[model samples]
Target: MTDHSLYVLLRKLEDAKIPFTLARDRPDTIRVTMHLVGERTEIDVFDDGHMEVSRFCGAEDIVGDEALVDRLIQENRD
Candidate 1:
């Protein structure tokens, strides 16, 4: 993202009181990661004004009974 966009994003995050960490910082790109709810979100902002976003759902956030596993297996076989 552009510098302005990056600044805006950081400002919004701060305003909302969300916590984020700088995972990587380089001359070409900056990577930020944050956990929200039950998932982790990653954002990469490049000097070229491009951005990428990714989300990860941890296994610990998953909740289900034994029947849920069977249902998942059945669905996967379809």
Candidate 2:
């Protein structure tokens, strides 16, 4: 994603009290992932501002924040 968008996302996550880590995926790509109680969410940001998010959950259902996932998906997609 664009630098602005990524910054906004990081701010949102911080505001929501969600803990995540950012790492370099490629020369022009960044990867952000959050580790929740029983699940994980990953978002990959590209230099051109495109993004893709994936959620991984265990067999049991969870009560994590759905709004955050929705916002991420809505904001970042092909």
Task: Measure candidate 2: CA RMSD.
Answer: 12.2
Assess the local accuracy of residue 35 in candidate 2 as a C-alpha lDDT between 0 and 100.
74
Model 1 residue 61 lDDT score = 48
In Å, residue 54's CA in model 1 sits off its true spot by 0.7
lDDT of 2 by residue, 1-78 (tens): 545767878888999999999999689879889878878899987877788999998866555698989988999988
Q: Residue 65's C-alpha lDDT in candidate 1?
A: 91
Residue 74 in model 2: lDDT: 92
Task: Name the 10 consecutive residues with the lowest summed lDDT in model 1.
Answer: 1-10
Q: Using TM-score, give the best candidate's number.
A: 2
Residue 17, model 2, lDDT:
96
Cα lDDT of model 1 overall? 0.79
